[model samples]
Target: MDLKLVILFLFPVVIGSLGNLSLLCHSVFLYCSGHRSRSIDVIVRHLTVANTLFLLSRGIPQIMAAFGKQDFLNNVGCKLVFYLQVTAKGVSVSTTCMLSVFQAITISPRSCGWAELKLKAAKHIGRSVIMFWVLHMLLNIRVPIIVSDKRNNTNIMNIIDFQYCSVMISSKEKTTTFVALTLSHDILCLKLMIWSSSSMIFILYRHKKRTQHIHHSSISSRASPETRASQSILILVCTFVSFYALSSLMYVWFSLYIKAAWWLVKTSALTNAGFPTVSPFILMTREQFVCESTRKK
Candidate 1:
C-alpha cells in the first residue's frame, strides 16, 4: 500500500464527513427549532446531503481498496455504490445551479419581474429539490445495470475498474446515448450556474458603484446580508466549477484512452471528489451559519 495515497484519501474523507455532518446537523437544528430557513438555506441543506453521500460512497471503498482489499464489493454492492455516487454528483450539480439561480433572483432589482418569481420560487423549492432527485435518479437508473464486479482491475476492455467496483459499459450505443444525455444535463447546469453567477457579480458591481460616494466605513456597512450571502454562494459556485471542469476533463481522457495508468485513475477519483471535500467549509462561513453555530454552543 502506498502510505501517501492512503493518507491523501483518508484526510479528505475524515474532514469532509465532519464538515458536511456539522452543516447537516446545523440545518436540521434550524428547522427543528422553528427558525425559518430561506430557500437558499434549504438548497444548501440538500447540497450538504448530496456531498455527504458522495464522500461516503467514494471514500469507504477507496480506503478499503487502498489497504490492499480487492474484490470487496460484490455484484450488488458494486451496482448500488456506483449508481449512488454518480447520482449524488448529478444532484449536487443541479442543486448548486438552483442555489445560484435563486440567489440571483433574490438579489435582483425589485422593479424587475423577479419579485413575483422569487416568491414563487421559494414556495416551490421542495418541488424543485424533489424534481432534481427524481431527474438524476431516473436518468441514471440504468447505471447499475452496466456496473458489476470485475475480476481484474487491469482490463483494457473495462471503462472504469476501481479495483472493487468495476463498470463494464460494454454497449457502445448505450454508452454514446448515456454520454450525450449526461453532457446535455451538465451543459444546462453549467450555463445556468454561470449566468446566475455573472448576474450576481454585475449586481454587486452596480451596488458598489452606487455606494462609492459613501465613506469607506459606510461602504463596509452598506454590504447587506444578502450581498454577503450572495458572495459566499459565488465562492462556492466557483469552487464547484473548478473541480467540475477538472473532473470532466479527466473523465473525457479516461473515456478516450481506455488504458489509463493507475496513478491517473487515482488522480481522477480525487478530482471527482474534490468539490464535496471543499464546499462545506465555504458554506459554513455564512454569517448566519456561524452565528447560529455559536449561539447553539
Candidate 2:
C-alpha cells in the first residue's frame, strides 16, 4: 500500500472517470435532443463507455491494492476483472479505429470510391460495435482459467502479477497462442487507423491545393469546417497510437526481460491508461470548436 502507487492510480481513476462521464453525458444529451444524430455522436457514446470500463477495471484494483487490501479479489474476481479490462481495451481500440475510418469516409470526395462506404458505414455502426465486443469476449474466454488471486493459488510457475490479481500461464504453448491472438487483434485495428489517417491527410492536402489554385493564394484566412473536423480526428487517432504503442513496447520489454520489474508493470499500466484518460478531452475539443463556429455565425 504505497502512497505513491495510490496517488498514481488516483489521477487516472478520478480525472479519467470524470472526463469520460462528461463525454458520455454530452453524447447521450445530443442523441436525445430530437435532432438528427451524427455518426460521431454514436461513436462517442460507445467509445466513452469502453474508456470508462477500461479505467475502472484497470484502476480500481490498483487503488484497492494500494490501500493494503491483500487478496482483495478472489479467483472469480480476478477472472472477471481481467476479462473486462482486456475486452474493454480491445473495444476502445477498435472503436477509435472505426472513428478514424468513418471520418475519412465522411470527408472524402463525393466522386471517390469512399462515397459508397459512407452510405453503408452509418448503417453498420450498431452491428460493428456488437461484433467487436463479441469477438474480444470470445477471444479472451480463456482468461478465467489463467487468472487467479495469488493468495488463493498454490501453483506459481509463471505468474504475472497486477498487485491484486495474477495470471498463471500454464505452458509456453498457451502463452504463445494468447500473445498471438492479442497481437493480431491490436495490429489489425492499428493498421486500419493508420490507413485512415493517411487517407485523411492526403485528402486534406489535395483540398488545400484546390483552394490555393482557385484563389491563387495561400488559402484559409480561416480553416474550413471540413478541415477542422479532419484535424480533430487526426489528433485523436495520433494520440491513441502514440500512447498505445509506448505502453505495448513496455509490455514486450517486460515479457522478454528475465527479472520481474514490478515498477515497470506499474509504469506500463499508467501508460496503458493514457489514451482513455486523454481521449475524452480530445473529443470535447471538437465540440468546443463547433460551438465557437456556430456562435460566430
Compute the lDDT for candidate 1. Answer: 0.84
Which lDDT tens digits does candidate 1 get at residues 50-96?
99998899988888889888778888898899888999999999998
Clashing pairs in 2: none
Q: Tens digits of per-residue lDDT for model 2 on 26-63?
A: 87786688645776667778899999999999999988
Candidate 1 lDDT score at position 77 = 90
Candidate 1 residues lying further than 4 Å off, grouped into runs, are 152-156, 219-222, 287-297
Residue 267 of model 1 has an lDDT of 92
TM-score of each: 0.92, 0.92
RMSD of each: 3.0, 2.3
Candidate 1, residue 48: lDDT? 88
